[model samples]
Target: MMISRKLVYVASLSLGLSLLASTAMAKVEMNAMCFMKQSESTAHAFNPTKEEIADSSILKKNPTNVTDADVDAKFRIASLSKVITTDWAIAKLGPEYRFKTKIYVTPGTKAGNCNLHIEGDMDPYMGREMLTRIFTQLKPKLTAQSCKYIETFSYDQYFPVYLDAMKHQTNHDLGWEDPARYFNSTKTKNDLAAFLKVKSGLKGDFSNIGVVTKDRYQEYLKGVPSKVYSVKSRPLFMIAKDMNKYSYNYPPNVLFEKLGGAEAYKKFAADRLKLDGEDVEMYNGSGYPAMIDGKKMYNLVSCSALVHIMQDLDKTLEAYKGTRKFQMADVMAVGGPGESYSTFKGLYAGGTYDNTMVAKTGSADKAITFGGMLSTADGDMYFAVLTSPETYGGADTTKARVIIRELVQTLAERQKLKKFEYKQIGDMNATDDQSTLVEEPKQTPAGSLK
Candidate 1:
């Protein structure tokens, strides 16, 4: 009896060890790809039949058997979310739109003493250079006409400062700093006052910055300003161009919030691109991760949906009427030695791939993705590569990037697409005219500027 029991225990231990080994081997990583050749008008599926295989056919690979579901499976796309945000802005706001900041002066009891009211549109590109221009313009007007020192300053609720949200009026904190380190609005009130004093170079203590009730601000908006001046930001397309080239997180988030958040974005995606809700879960515009239900979630987008977005964006930019022509390279990072500051310059800079690709690269703790158009012999090939090392037999980011580079190189060679060339029309980092001052209409009728 004792010998039989010992044999049974040994068998059970062996089975348990076998199961553990199997589970360990199953923890491999995964990769998915979707390629759409413009000429074929079809997205290639992964590892398709030889006859069905083409540059446009949607293709993908994984540890398990590849299926159509994998093509539509949502993957956290990291900074690629900026592409979607740019698309929305181009469609809704147009390429020429510029953000505005309006200023109103209400003279105080003493001459040349005014209580200042600034209405901001949450300009995402507000930086030292832009701020310097605004203050430079303000100095002459404020010192000559209204007030040498702003007796008290108040701005709209949307001002990107740390104190405004802490007053318990907003739903959440607005102290989060953007990736550009431009405004640094997360600091305390004193920091703002000191910063403003230096930026303006005026002889006034600006520590008395105040906030008015929402009702009062609205009333002021409806009433014509007795004394007013305004500053406008660079056009929307230029802003979008810089945002993507640098992959700055703040600009897209501001634009996203201005466009009505995730729910609105979902509706837009569904209606415009026919993207299914399951494949388009965007919590924020920047593609930054969020915490929900005690779990961290990044912006999830399927490979097909992302390709479709790139296709649509290209078309939209092509058709847009503007002073100067716009192309995908204008709004996306170009892969070449020409654009020294672009995020993808280093990766695709060799002579063979140089300037032939305009792409966006996204990375997260678990996800490394690349998506955009590849100029090909057949036509422009829109593609998305989503990779993660968390799945079964997964590889780290470095290995995944190497694999992708080789894959892209192979595809280019197979299709005879390496001959395509993209000559940048102007310097990507060229600055627009900053001195052009757009004065708001002296009399803005009731609710017109709102």
Candidate 2:
């Protein structure tokens, strides 16, 4: 068939624009091009088509933009990686892998001067209620009464110090120390208790449910753990929800640590997705501390990747029917016209007096960070945005927010489209075999839904 003139014209125009964009972008140190598309899960697995693709590496008019042969440019993903990682975990491990911070008394249970071994399987926002549950459970029974905490404390005891769930720091020597470290309690055990107290607005002389200052003394049990020990932490889905809503860093990192260690997941991602060691760089899991360029820097992803992952998570809505009410997407963070103001983004970002977006975000080494999903006010779409590596330019997260908002705007616009910039977006070679099994609520294919 003879080439159509209309087709030729559009291709030429896009090529010219992409080339121009490349030239302009290269002037900025390093570069990379990656377009994200909404993903649909097929019976066999998942595939993201190109019509869903949106790009930032180049304008739409480059003369020599990459042909289908060049989809391998190292696109930096930043916190956009959170959704990718989280969804992968859910898909692989099943959604039932929700976090549970459990409190246990050391075997042969002892009181004062005796240890209360607590194991928090990585829940960041798991503040006071969970703590109160532990205290309340052990309340009438905890044997420690008027005992003294040893002065020599291991500083590393207090930790929300997770970098990536699936990975760990090569070195465990954290520099500065926290007073909470003295609690060796690091707050999860007691800080959690205090936070619960504040949350319940519990009445008088109930003063010291969970409090630890310079000194932590043991006392007889009086608190109730079960009245407070109620809900399964908002669910991993909700945790991801809140992460995006707040654009908070700590939780995303914690989730990564909780879901799987960073190192292990990287291996999982590589095996599952078949990642080339050089195609992407995996550091500290989140965006900061590293970057990517056109040559192929996968240090992390961007706001674009974040939204695409949300699209995948949205597909699983049929599973959470019994637990959650649908949440609003991160409208502001997603970046369409008044996306934040008119949609769920604001709710999650603390937009309205009520309602909220829930998602995970990450920021490290002064690098700007982003992650979070938005459910619009209309309640149909979910938008998630994540950004990183711009600490090289923009100021704090405010600038990152603008970039994230734009990324969301672009991706959501793609969601509204019918045609493509003209190409397929994923690589068949892109499967993640390194996946570890994740348990869930008996999953069916995405197609099983209406």
Candidate 3:
């Protein structure tokens, strides 16, 4: 009996040590893979830095030959900046926060000349159909009062002016000839007038509508502006879904404005994320236009800093998943075969990463970036890959995407060996069974934006 017990103990100890050795080997492999080769053309300029953290321990880091300054160096994260903007908005405003547009009516001196004020709360997704609904709700009241003509029609001047400046700045940076592409304040007002006219059966075009100056905006505040009706935008999470999925610029730009412009946004992120002043910097919500004033001034964030932010975002989202109908995957683009906004779907779809990676991708002339959480058998792993401008140029994102995939796949494989229970946040639609995998969720219809 003593000899049998000794044999069993020896076997168990050998198995434990083997597992540890395997884990250590996997870590070494991952560390080696993280060091990407620099391009010959710009080998001098190429500076690649990556950091991966799992369970509060650094799994892989390539800091050799790269100084602390290089590790801390900020690269233009491109659309990855959207992750920061959307994450910040979600934290500050909650996932369910909605933008409100209010309609006010006041008696006019003449029989058919009452003033109508449409106050906008910077709702970026407000569309013609939504305006029609607002007008439809207020039609009965207006018709009952015999209000045939709108004597003075005005909207919030502050937001329109700010939007104009933002549009101009974006156009200037992109060298876009048509500033109207970004935003046309006049067109928006006119569209609102047309929609309201059709819905309310009112007469005349916006020529009859008056523009409210900053000074005139206060007059409506003197007397209680009789509220006729109002419309609330879709929840912030839904907006975030479209923003990250499509890499839409307007929504995030407007959101940053709502958060009190770029400078204020930086301060807010620094305070909330506990990041140093140099750790995060963003001129615009989107990281396009890699330069400003001859110097490349794109949104700069270190890999580790972004990974930490992503981890915090994951925790914040977990708190809401149980109570809310939407999940983090619903807001972020997922990898797979179907119509996903995941830029990596072309390369990673139908592969091992399908439905397992929920991330954001950013690319421009000088920088390529990707950062998000990867669900593994052990647990969730937060990762961010930032390639210096020298690594990619002109339409070639293949190298970056390929490297990211290999690294993630290696990590997943290592986790699988541990036999750790697979736990994932939200519904990632992941599966170990090869036969069960399907395409990603279809794109949300335009009407659903409401």
| Winning candidate number (TM-score) | 1
Predicted model with the maximum lDDT: 1
- lDDT string for model 1 (175-279, tens) is 223332333444424444655777666665576776564468768656543467777777787677766766666678778877888889989998888887777
- Descending-lDDT candidate ranking: 1, 3, 2
List per-prediction Cα lDDT, in the order shown: 0.63, 0.35, 0.53
The digit string of per-residue lDDT tens for model 3 on 240-344 reads: 766676566666766877777678877777777777767787777766553356775667776656766776666677676445554456567765434433344
lDDT winner between candidates 1 and 3: 1
- Model 1, runs deviating above 4 Å: 1-28, 39-42, 47-66, 161-191, 210-215, 221-225, 292-295, 348-351, 391-395, 418-435, 444-450
Estimate candidate 1's alpha-carbon lDDT, on a 0 to 1 scale. Answer: 0.63
Model 2, residue 344: distance off in Å is 10
Clashes of each: 21, 88, 0
- lDDT for each residue of candidate 2 in 203-290, tens digit (9 for 90 to 100): 2223333322212211211221111111234345435443443343345555555556557666755675545444444553333332
Q: Relative to the unseen true structure, what is the C-alpha lDDT of residue 255 in candidate 1, on a scale of 0 to 100?
A: 84
TM-score of 2: 0.47
